[model samples]
Structures are given as C-alpha cells and as structure tokens.
Target: MNTRKRQLAMTALGVATLAITAVGTQGAPPAPPWFTWTTVVNNGDFMPTDSCVPTAPSTPPCRTFNSYNQPSVNANQVVVIRARSRGGQGGQAVHGVYTRDMAAAGPVVRILDRSTLVPQPNNLDSTFIEPPSFPRIDIGMDTVATRGNHQPVWRYFLDDVTETRAGTTGVYTNPFGDLIAGASKLGAVPDFSFFEVPEAPGTPFDVFPGAPAVTDGATIAFKGNYPVNGVGKTGVYYRDLENAPIPLSADNLEPAGGSNPVVLIANSLDTFIPGTRTIFGSTAPPSAANRQMVFAGFDNEDKPTLGGIYLAPLNGTTQPPLRTLVAIGGQVPGENSKARFNRLGEGVSFDGRFVAFWGAWGTEKKTLVLQCRTEGNADRVAFCNQQHPNGFITTVPVNQGIFVHDLGTRQTQVVAKTPADYDDFVYWNFSGRTPGTGEGDDDGELARWRSASFVAVSGLVDGTLTDATFHAAFKARTGILMSGTYAEPVDGIYLREGPGKASLLTLVETDMDGSLIDPEAVDDLGAALPVTEMGIERDGFRGNSLVINASMGTEETGWAGIYLTEVPE
Candidate 1:
C-alpha cells in the first residue's frame, strides 16, 4: 500500500450506518471462480454536497463522487471520503462523508450531507481551509465496537475545526472546554485534546503520526507523541479510547521512571515514537478475553540504538505488561545497520500468537529472516539467536524476504528465500546484472499473505527462465502471487491461485453503465486508466475484499475513484 492509502486505513475512526443492497452469497460451493463483483458505489448514485458545481443546468450545483477518496470497512459496513463540490476551472473541491451497509439493500447514505452553497474563496484562517463549510474528513480504521452496543465505530481526523488559544467574541469558544498550548484544530474528536500542542515545559508534539487501530471491544490504541506538564519529555504515547488518554510508554513508565520512558519495553530509548501497531484477537467480533497488540518502534529521534518490534497485552490495566520480543544487535554481523523489521505496518496472527514481517538486510547477498516470541514477556533475542546464530535462515541475492516468528516456541523461521534459491529469481527489468535493479528502492512496499499460505508480492521479477515460467515456478515453491506484462496483461490488477495460472482481478476500461449512478446524470461517466495502486486488507473482513484506486484519461477527465471488491469465501 502507498503512504496515503496506509494512512487512510490507519486513521479511519467513526460509527455510521448506510443502506446496503444485500447480495446473497454464492449458492454453489464457496471457492475461487465463485467470486462475484458487486458495485458498492459508482458515480451518479453517489451524491455530493449541494455546494459542488453541477454539470447540467437543471441540476443543482455539485460535484461528482471524487476519485481521490480512501475507503475503510468492517464485517458489516464500508466507509469512504466523498468529495461533493468540484472546483470549476481553477477552484478547489469540497468533501463530505458517505457509507454503505454490506448486509442491507439501498443506495449509498450520506451521514454528513454536503452543502448546496456555491464555491467560495478559501479562508485559510477558518477551521476548514477550503470552500466547503464542513470539516475535511480523513477516514481511517473502522471497527465493530461492542462497548458502543455493537455499533460500527470508524476513526477519522477533521481539519477546519477551531482550536482557539484565546476565546473569541461569540465566534468561537473552546469546544474542548479545556485548552492546550498550540492553536491547531487538525486532529481526532470525542478525544480531541490527545493531539493538541501542550504549553511550554510539556511535550508540544503534533497529531499522531501513524494511524490508530480499533478492536471489536471498542478499544482504540494509536501512536501519539505526548508531553507531560512540567516535564520536558517526548515519545510515541499509546492511549486506549475506553478511558482518558494515558501514556503506555510515558517517561514515568520507563526504566528511569522520568522523562526517559521505557517505550513499551524493560529499557528502551525515548526516540521510539511514530511506530505502527496491530491489535489481534478471535475472528469477527474479536474477543477481548485474549486480545493483544503487536508493534514496531523506530529510533526516529536518533537515539544511539537501533529499534525493534515489541508486544504488549491489552487486559484493561493502567500499565499492561510489555516486553522486547526482538531487539537490535544480535548474532548477525553489523545487524544494527543491515537488518530492520518491516516498518510499513504491523501484522499478527488471527489468534494473536505468531507475528509475520519482512526483514530487509540491505544490498548484501543475504536476507535476514528472524522472529521472536509474542506469547510471553521473556526476552527471546537469545532464543532467536540460538535458533539461527548466523542471524538468518539462509543467504540469497534477494533483499526482500518474509519471516514468521512463532510466539509459543520463541523461534523464527524463514518462510521465503533460501541460499538454494539464490539468483533463481530476479526483479523486474532485470538485465541479469547488478544486484538490486528495477524499482528496487523500497518505499511503499506491500507484501500481504492472506489466511492461506500464499502471498501477493508487488513489483515484477523474473528468474533463470521466462517471466511466466519464473512466476509459475516461484508460486509453486513459495506460494507467491506475482505477475507482470511479460506474464499477464498490462495495466490491470490480477489475482492468482498458486500452483496454477494468474487471473485478472480488475478491468482497465469499462462503460459508465456499470456505475451506481444514472446514465444521463453524469458526463464522461466511463472509467479509464488501469489499476495504478492496490491494497489488500490484512485483517478484518480482509479474507474476501481488496481496495484499489483508479483513474480515467487525465486530471481533466476526472482522475480518480477508490473502489472495494469482494471475492468468493
């Protein structure tokens, strides 16, 4: 997933319901080929606020459903950021919120309806910097919270809300009742103070960098930078939505018990903020009886040490138990600089036992594959070393490798890549020379393996054989669903059932008739461009769905729209 998509998935926070047209499950056996494509929301059917400039004269001034939207989902519903007002010629677009029920039958519902007012010049000083009078809503992760009576709660960040440092003359009074040091109104709500800038002598940090994760129990845990009053301290703070925001890795909770917080470990540095977290438990309607959180902290603050992933319990305690499942500096030579956890995001087993993540070992002719225990608070770095003293299962020319750490055994296993397969696979555009080539620079690397043993690796790579032959062989051996122009059609999303051939997952061109909106209601209703980007939900109704952002001919042709799809169970 890209940075923007990752942020959308992580930042989503809210609870709203919409009408859904119930599509019956496949009557035949549940398997591949049983997949069905249903349109959640297309243009025309999706209504923007009245403020948007309308394309037709008889129609009210409005904008079409924006293509730049990001979507989030739970077992029962899907939410997205829909733009209502289109900026005419050189104007700015206005946005609104929308949702759809996965179980009911109806059109997409607009919870925060858009305004009908004409586009106005932006007042940068106002809560909303743009023309829309509504707050700019950025949706993040969504969860089915039982605490709120099984309601669907979605996480979101609102821009344009007032955070006045000084009271106004009836124009604005602090809605939060209390005030923080900074006067910025860009943060989450129902708990807005969590992102405010504190006064001097306190850690005046910005909003949570990474997004928050919500559990089925209505508990939310996020990466936040908080400053304590009278204490000059700063670090990523972990807060649960059930109570007041408290620092799980605060300065007081560190080994020194002051400004130097432990950062979710026995003795870790304070530079480990801006980390990613994953909350795991039983299937849908996750049970809190055995829920847990796994995360990786980075030394972004430039501490003299390398960062590692940590695990903690969410048993409703003020300070739940925490430990260093994996730390820096091990048996591997120069591991401090060579090996690093897949920091893109966190991934945990359904039962919250084993956690899987990729470890990049740099350009060296080796892939560092390691794991640690998540079942206990014991230090497992020694155990991990004992299992693989060389710091990896095998050495291969490939830099990207997957590893799974068994929490129970406290042992790590290399799931992908081995010395035996060295030079067996080459990245896309491989000239059969140079170690790392062809889109090798990892930025938004997304490697997700579903409930099955197979995984979909982004980017194209060939082996000693043709691209098709290489992909087939690789999938047979590693269960990796990989494809490219040499093996499949170009400019489209495709899914493969390992051990066989790849199948197209999406279309590069389609008419507007498939859209949920009326035929005459929209102009240039056809969708163009191919699947430019895609992200498979790692958990939470992810087994059957995936998200993609697509575009038409160009920006003038209405450039983007985010869509969600479901496959056979």
Candidate 2:
C-alpha cells in the first residue's frame, strides 16, 4: 500500500471526511481492489442502429441516449464522445460523434452524425450541426479531433448565381484510420485568408472557439477568431495533419504550401504576459500533447490582472518563444507568502509534461443570496423581484487554486485550495434567466457562478523529473456541513496522487451510495441512489484512466451516465 497508506485507505474509502462516518456505513467506499467501474454510455441507452440513431419514435433508427459531453480518454482506452438524442425523427436533435473501446467491450462507434455527409464543396446541403461540445482523443492515438457545426460550406460569388457565405465552421479528423471509417476534413473557417495570419496577416476566421486539440502527430491545436477592421483578433493555430497541403475543395480550403495556420499565439503578436509588460489580450483553448502546446493567456482582455500558463512548440521550424508555465504575479504555491496569483484558469490540462491549471487568489468574496422561488418562474419570480428589490439573486465567491505545473521540474504542485483546502472555488446557481434579458443583464443579474475547478493531469510516459509518478483528476465542490450549521455541499471526483504525496481520493461523491452508484441501483426508498452530479473535463483525465459525467437518482429514479475508473497503482 504506501502512497501515504493508499491515501489513508482512500480517505477511509472515498473522502468527504467519510461523510459523517459514511452515515452508518452500508455501501460505497470499499472498492479498492484496484478500482474498476466502466459504463461508458447511459441515459436510457439504446442508440446504435447504425449510429446517430434518428428515425423519430421508431423504425430502424430507434434513439434514446439523451445527453453527454465531457469525455476524451486515449492512451488506447479509446472513448471519445459528444452525444445527444431523444427527439429524433422529426423534432430533429440527434447530434453525434462517438467512440468507445475501453479495451474492446465493443459497440458505440459512430463518429460524426446528424446523418453524416457534409464533406463536399457544397451548396448548402450540409449535415452536422453540432459536434463540439468537447470531442477530442489522441494522446497517442485513436485520433479524433472535432469542431463541426454545419451549413455554409464556403462559396462566394454574388454577381453570378452561386452565393453562400457563413463561414462553415471546421476542424475534423480521424487520422489514424477506421475511427468511423476514417473521418476527414480538418480545417475551415473559410479556409484561411486576409493573407492567412501566421506572422500577422489577419482577417478570415470568423471564429472557431473551442474543441480542437489533437496531437500524437496528427497535430490540430486550434482557437482562431478574426475580425480586423472591427477589432477582434485572437490566435493560437496549428494544422499539420501529418503535413497539411490537401484541402482544396469540398470547401475545405488550405493549399498553397498549406494555407498558413501555424501561429501558436496571437493578439498583438509580441505575446508577452509572462512576467508582464502586458501583451496577449486573449488566448485560451489549446492543450495538445507530445507535439506540445498548452494555453491560457490574457493580459487584459478587458480587465485581466496580467495572465499566465503557456508553453508552445509544435515543432515546425522557426517559432519558439513561449514557455512560461504559471504566472500572474506567481507565488500562491501552498499559499501565504503574500498569496499572489490573481486569476488564471481557462481550461488547461496538458500531458506532455504536466500542466493542469486553475489559479485565483484573494479578493476573497462570498455573497450568494439566490432565491427567486428557488430558481424562478412566475415570469422568473416576478423578474426576480423586479430586478432585486429583494426577492433574491446575488453571487460573488471565487477564490480558486488547483495547480500542477512541472514542465520538467519548474515545479508548482498544490492540487486543491480556497480558504485553505476547500470552501468555495465558486459555485452559485439559479440562472433561470428571463428577467431583464440575456448577456450579463445590466448587472442586476439573476445568478450564475462557475469555477468549480475541473482539472486532469497524468504523467510517467517515460517517468523521470523525479518520477513519483504524477496523476491528478479533479472537479471539486466541498464547503458545508459544519456539523451543526448544516449547509452540506459535497460534489466530487477527486484523485490527486504524488503532489505533496496523496490525500484526496474520493473518486465520486455527492451523497454517493446508490450502491456506490450501480450495484443494482435502488431508490424507492430501498435507498442507494445518491450521487447527484459530478462531471470532470479538461479532457477528462487520461492514462490510468478517469472519465466522468454522472448524476444519480430522482427526476424519477434518475440516472444519467458516463463513467470509467482505474487509478490505483
């Protein structure tokens, strides 16, 4: 046993300080044979009638699956997802992109849906109106990049009958073969132009926001924006699908020494923001591996206290200057030394050499309120008391920390924090909008809070950097149950192993006990349905496996699923 007595026997069988001694111990907590769990697809199951399902209420296609997003895994355990169904046949909404292998239990393949087929120099008969709510996988193969929202397929004429312009959205791949018949098309956003950006050319990338990191040599890494005369620039690119150059038409563009895209960092270009002379006014959305890349920047994209986390190097020749790992005034390691870092998190969890991020320090807040009849509807509790004359709606709390860092020993460590080990890493709710109207509604907001952590990190590909064998896994919530004060929060999915050596084992929480979530699933008071919500994404942990998305009983014996476990060595 050893890693601090197997993290104190996994903190006495799954931490949360053993929820009041596991409320009279009866289930969950004794699973340490080496921890197994699996169940990669759930929410009424059924799908696969040849993928994407669809066909409405019945007939050949079937349907079922419901929802899921946040799954990636691939050190060969495969698993890549982004699902949504139930509504099919006519109420549309089938959405797809799937994969499953978990060492071959078979079934769940499908990659790309909405009836698949938008790969042509089109005329608006597109397919794929969705597939980018996280769908990546390639940490050493099963290649699966994604970013697809269809419909425009690039074509512009205007004076000669043939006009289509709406930036078709792109980035797709299947590279290592047979992942749903070798998927395809990997770059679009009107296929680069305004001279293709790279050293600085600017203008044609109407936006490609998230979902696009894939390396293990298939190289994809993305985040583009482009506006130019109306401001908005943003960067961080990369293409190299094993060498680029063949995209010419099916409206996929790139061809002329492979249409640019290898920039790595943009916004004003001098890049800066490490020790700060202030430069990158924006970046985030990148986390590749082996070909290296990790992002998160922002030296003032309208109020940012410096900015941090970098590391770039796609290795395509000249272009090598970003390497800082954590920086926004630094300090904040285990805290107090004047606790620095004023905010850093924009999703990071690289694996090339451990990066896992989330940082925030001081400005310590805590307001909360929230109560428009528990979350509106009487026209949002009378527009939340006509915009707060006090029916309730507040929110402040967000002091975070969840670090890892170690770019070959630059060292950083601390994997959880906020009021010294959990109290509020931000979490509010009640955004039953409809009150004033969307988008920050004149600041008298109705409620919205998030920063509930979310991390990943794994290590030891070849070990050494003082190899104690990393490992992270996150998604925290904790902060309540003061014995007699009674707030009782909990929420979980934690792992942490060799960062200051063990003590956060949990692996699933929020009233856990539905037979530790599936030992036959009970709940009509035959108890055992607990677990309410857990999720984890920043490419949901890989290599030694982690992959979550859960919700357990009651919307009528509820269940929602996607789970995989394995971390014990």
Candidate 3:
C-alpha cells in the first residue's frame, strides 16, 4: 500500500478503538446540530432531455449528469451550478448551467446548455461550447451571470466569401425573469459595435476571465481583458443592466447608444495598490453585494506578499476609491505584534458587511513530498520518472489561516490557522494526462495547487457595523503526523460563530456516514459509504444556507453530489 492508504488504515484502527470506548463511557454523543442535510443534486441524475441536440451522427442522447462544480446559493435558498454529462453523447461532453429552488424542493431547471443558441447581435445566432464554471446568482434576486464560450460570430468579407473571426467568448446573463426562457445576450466580444472596453474607447474586449458576479440591483461585475496601443490591459468592470436594453425581442436588438457602457472599477495600469507605492498589477474576480464590491489586488503578480483585499463602493456617483480591508504585511489578529501576513489568496467571500478570506503568515514551513501514483500506466511512470529524477516532488509550505474582516467595524478576526486548527490550508496535485512521445500540451495542472479553505460569512445585514453576530463557514484539512506514523488528515467544513471564537462546529467531514450525502448510497459490502471528499468555493455560503459538493464511497464503488444545510447564527 502507498503511504496515504497505509496512514488511512492506521487512523481507521485508532478511530474504531476510540468509538468503542466512547460508546461504553458516554453511550454516544448527540449528533451535530448543523447536519440537517438536504440533497440538491447528485451524479447520475438524469438531465433535461430537451437539452440534448443531435448535431452529429455520433452525438448520443444527453443522459445523466456525471460531474459537478462548486455551487453558489442565494438568500432565497436558490442554488446555481454548472455541471457536465458524460458518455451518452459520444461526440462531446454536454455541459450546462442550472438552478434549483431548494426551499420548495423544486426540480432542477436548465438555464443554458451546449445545445442552446447563443443570443448575439443582429440575430447572428451561435452555439455555446460550454458554460464556464462558477455560475453566480444575485443574493436578493435570481439574476444569473456567467461566462460562455461559444462559436465565433464576428464575420468579414474575404475575397467575397464570409469569414468568421476567432474570438468567441464573453459574459452573459439571464435577467430578472424566467431564467430559462428569458435568457439573453448581455455582452459579447469581437463585436465592437455591441461591446467595448471601458475607457479604452474603440477597443473591443479580447476576453472576460472568470465567472461574472451579479448584484441584487442587476449590475454585473467582471474582470475583462483587452488590448490598448498593442499592449494587453486588464481591469474589473461593471455594467448596470437595469437601464441597458435586453435582447429579448427584435426591437431591442441593440442598446440605444449602440453599446452599453461598462463602468471601470479598477485596472492594472492605473489603480494604486492600497498601502503600497506600486499600482495594482492584477485583480481577481470580484464579489458584490448591497452596492459594494470586494476583490483582491496584487501589486506584484509574482509575489503573494504584495497583495491585499479591498472594498469598492458601487453606489457612489463617482467611482469611489478602494478601501484597504487587509494587506499582506498587516499584523495578524491575536498573534504577536511581529506576526504579519505573508500571503493572501485571491478568492474572497463578501456579504456587504463582512469579507471572509484566507491568508498565510509566520516563518515555520512544512514540506510535502509527492510521488506519482502511476497505477501501472507505463507512460505515467516514464513521465513521473523524467519529471522527478530523484523519485519524488516536494512542496514549500507556509503558515496559512482564515480570517473574517468586518467592513463596518474595520476589525479583523482570525478564524483558523495552521499548526493550531489544521495541518495545512493548501494542497498540490498533478492535473491533466501524461503527454505522448512527441511535444506536450500546456495543461495548467502539471504542478497546479489550490487552497483547502474557502470561507463565507453570514451576519446581520441591517446596514450596521456594530452587529456582533457573525458566523463564518470555512473548509479545513486537519490531522498531522506524529512520531513516525502519519495521522490521516481529515478534510472538513466547519462553522465558527461570533468573532474570535476558537471553537468550530463540524458541518461535514470525511469518513462521516454517507447518508449525509445520499442516504441510499452504499458500497458493495452493503454498508453506508463514508464521505470521501468535500468541495466549496468562495461563494458557497450565503445568508444562513451553506451548500457544498461531496463524494462518498469505499475504494470500490462511490458517488458524488451536492448537499445543502442550515448554519444557524
């Protein structure tokens, strides 16, 4: 057995012993109060047949969904997600964006899918390749916004023959109406007549990276990239859709001004990095609520120590300057005066009053050695050996922690940290397939990494800063190696209520009963499958509802799905 499996086996033995002793002493403790689990959607659930389109002879019928991305929940208990269906459609994977009203136990409704027509200018209909991940919904409303990759529609007359351009991606939204039937084109690229980069007049957007965020007021905030003077530029921008024309009818084919003007929030070339002398080199996708936006900015893209999170007000007549919420060099709360943040993650959770984020500090480091699990694939074995001649790869670890910053009070609260509440806050993995004998693909996951913690906050939204009732939900990986044996790390979602509270209530964790994921799922041995993996993006928690994606099973058989539960403050 590999090191990980061996460690799991040893940990299982210890846990079994503890369970027997606990039953004899305390006759089993009360179940966690936060686990009122409700299944949102699961793998193998049949998708809407209407979404399937037989474009090619090899195209098969769209059947059950096989995978899901992180989900987002709104205050109404509505969840918006992006999922993929595999196998049945042999030609290509069928991808789509969907929403469900968890409060009413309603059926899943499709917003858009690969077969759906891409609403474009002048009725130049196109089809989407896939709906990008991280589809978002407004907190107070159901306005959904996402980035869509579609067929290029920009056409030119070349030698009298119509030729289409290459650019084919842009931000889109479903305005406040029937999300499915009312979906319309919000903004798209290569069509300068309809969309242009703000401030860089006449320059059309090259691409919109990341999922767009929608406000309750129908304002869309996104990070857009374009070229200016033959050089590339990027910024975070927003467009007010309340007055913008909707392409729901032929008469509203285009905006009155030819193009809807997107207001610039910040850009890499001009926006000053708060608390630093250098300007912002880049900005992450923003989170907006209650007419305010929160985003992380970096003065040095290559250095995490030069980054911080800022809040920009969207209600002001003039673009208000950004207010520094936290910085990399800022003193960490409850730590020594000398302790300062050395790293800040790009993902943040903002609910108007509170901004929950993760950062790293301290000088202590942990090294993780990774060896490829070849699984008897000769190509993988050769690739791994060639990549790591020493037989292993190692990661340089830093101290990590999660924090909640109150915009009203201007106070920061440390929720959890490494070596105290968990072992590590981030993990690395190899992604993509091994290359063939020839040249290799530039897949992002060769040594890709992701943080284990994605935090969200819920508190009184009474427009007051003094409200002390703040609840934070974050993902954590705990357990550490002691002596020569490794204690299997427990990946879990936890809730920390109130500011500076050290105690955290377990919301969900690995090795828990599979009933929490799906009561009917079991392994081949006829026993409940234990929870295996959990996933939550930055926006997974909103209001009092926390939604997450989980995988359950034993080594042989398993299932994955999305689950929702209440986190009472």
TM-score of candidate 1 to 2 decimals: 0.46
TM-score of each: 0.46, 0.35, 0.81
* Candidates 1 and 3 compared by lDDT, better number: 3
Report lDDT per candidate: 0.30, 0.62, 0.66
User: Which digits, one per residue and each the tens of the lDDT, describe model 3 over residues 414-509?
Assistant: 887766667666644343346543111111123322233477777742223468667777887766554322377677777776675535566667
Model 3 residue 101 CA deviation (Å) reads 0.4
Cα error, candidate 2, residue 167 (Å):
2.2
* Candidate No. with top lDDT: 3
Lowest-scoring 10 consecutive residues by lDDT in candidate 1? 166-175
Q: lDDT value for candidate 3?
A: 0.66
- For candidate 1, write residues 1-569 as lDDT tens digits: 11111011111112122222211233532122222335455444435444433455234544456444334444333533333434462344444445565546455654333232111111122122211111111112233211000011122334665443311100000112121111112222223233333222222233232223444333433343333444433222322322122233321111111111112211122222223232211111111112466665444322213545566676544334555555433222223554543321233222244444434444455332333322211233334434445433333334443344445555544444323222222221101111222111111122111111212221112211112111111111111223211222122233322112222222211221222221222235443232222222223223234444344333444334545555331
Root-mean-square deviation of candidate 2: 21.9
Ranking by TM-score: 3, 1, 2
**Candidate 1: deviation at residue 374, Å?**
45
Q: How many residue pairs clash in all the candidates, one count each?
A: 29, 6, 0
